[model samples]
Target: MTEQGPVELIHLADSENSVIVRVVGATSAGLPGDGCLIAEIVAASEFANGRLTEVYLLPDDLDDWAEALELLAAGRTVSWMDDGRNPEVRIELKGPYISQGQTLNAVEVEVRDASVSLTAVRVLVRLPDDWVDAHRRKLDQVHKAWPLGAR
Candidate 1:
């Protein structure tokens, strides 16, 4: 896993603003995010002035989020960490972008961290229609790096 560096839990971006979540390491020995294999979550977004927050996300969160991405290729709207404790992401079709010489549907994204300060950023991002495929691969790598109870 070191060869590839950290796993990108999620990367939603556009021309100006972007949101990226990187899985840092495994959670504490006993405590987990409801059987969460991850510990540190690094959230960043240009839209949020600079960085958002480095919170924790349990394995269940990643599992459910992955499931949602699996259905993303079907033109579905999905969300993750929307509980407000962590950086929230809402993705849906918006416009278009050019990738691999093909035009693909864009994703209008909102990366918000409402931690009492009352700040939220919403921006349009151009993501490939099949972006889920890449996302799933990243999640697989994360699981391999930080399996349940492995720390």
Candidate 2:
């Protein structure tokens, strides 16, 4: 399958326990808070048909009303793993990751204040059940310590 460029990543905290991430074309789009280009999902392919075990952000072209419709689309299968560069910034989501749930079993989001782009965005799964709670707490601390507004 052919590979495509990384998508623009943006994050927003909907509430104390939930967050919203918007993935758009590799263009200069509006981002939440005051940060610019917080992080990126490098070398991401398209989402495949059937059940997905992890969170895969499908490009807008392949989705209809935010739902994937075609399996024959190019780059329909993708994977996300750590390259051992910065493991601390990796993100983790629950297994069988689906879009309809709206609430993930676990999620880890990495954020930075730099105006530059981050090369990697990691999403991890297949871990303990309680991993989400722990990560959420850590994210809360990060939000309090270095808010995107001030950065």
Candidate 3:
């Protein structure tokens, strides 16, 4: 993502500590590929004060969670809401990692938006990773019950 400047809030949040941003629109030159991806960010600074937090981005329809994994891998954005008022969100990759650890995994992305003022929403996500041998073995066993073609 080129240094395209600060991301503007087209659909601002309701509170100062939190804001909900989604992919309202996008632009593509269609050459080198990854054009301009946009999202309406809903973030808050004071989400909570603790360790081990779980955030959910619900979908509008019934679909597999694998879809989210696919989107994140492809650099496409998504959100929890499906009000049918905007385009599908592409995961915004342009943000700062809040964690100060030497090595961080599945860290949240924080952005400086005028809507959220001094606060920001902590966007935490888990990307795809390799499955351990033991886990894969268990999955192999489970798959046997619902084989490829057993109907």
Candidate 4:
């Protein structure tokens, strides 16, 4: 029997309970958002021969937060935008991190604005459940070394 490889996961959300998660291959085209690149993840039952049956965007009306949370628990990246109209909150992936066949999981995004300075932004990408404990400890170090603001 052939072993099924790990599924690629990406997630997006907002402060107002909006969330979207997608699973696809490295070469698949990502869903376009205002400033971030997102992919759509449909229900497994709805997948017809490896295609998504539906898609979603931020600020959904339905109460689907549970499902969204489940996807995050399953090792999907979770990203959230502050407000759709805020230009400073816009987040873009930088080089080296954006590569083919890589999966991001449980990414938390916080957007802030200051009077004396530009917007202060924070992004947190949670390591996978199966990752070594040492890797999780590196999260702070990684972000500390990163330059502030979006690309």
> Of the candidates shown, which would achieve the greatest lDDT relative to the real structure?
1
Q: In model 1, which regions exceed 4 Å deviation?
A: 1-4, 30-48, 96-101, 149-151
List the lowest-lDDT window of 10 residues for candidate 1. 36-45
Q: What's model 2's TM-score?
A: 0.24
**Of 1 and 2, which scores higher on TM-score?**
1
- Which tens-of-lDDT digit does each residue in 1-151 have in candidate 2? 0033323222322223222232322212363322432333232212211111113322222222112112111213222222232122223333444445443333444322122345333333233334334434544443443333443
lDDT of 3 by residue, 50-149 (tens): 1211122222211322444456455555552234333223334433334445322242344433333354335544322331232234333323422222
**TM-scores of the models, in the given order?**
0.75, 0.24, 0.26, 0.21
- Quote the positional error of residue 1 for candidate 3 in Å: 43
lDDT of 4: 0.31
Total clashes, candidate 1?
1
CA lDDT of 145 in candidate 1? 69
Candidate RMSDs in Å, in order, are: 3.5, 16.2, 16.5, 17.1
Query: Positional deviation of 27 in candidate 1, in angstroms?
Result: 2.8
Provide the lDDT at 148 for model 2. Answer: 38
**Candidate 2 clashing pairs?**
91-122, 91-124
Q: Write the per-residue lDDT of candidate 1 for residues 1-151, one digit (tens) a residue.
A: 2456666777775566566777655444555444444433333345344454446777668777887886676778887778876767777777566777978767776666657465555666676666778888878877776675454
- lDDT accuracy of residue 75 in candidate 1: 71
Off by over 4 Å in 3: 1-64, 84-91, 94-151
lDDT of each: 0.65, 0.29, 0.33, 0.31
Residues 9-125, model 4: lDDT tens digits: 333332222212332222223535432222343212111112221232232211123343444445454333233332122223322233246543334434343332454444544
Q: Alpha carbon lDDT of residue 32, candidate 3?
A: 34
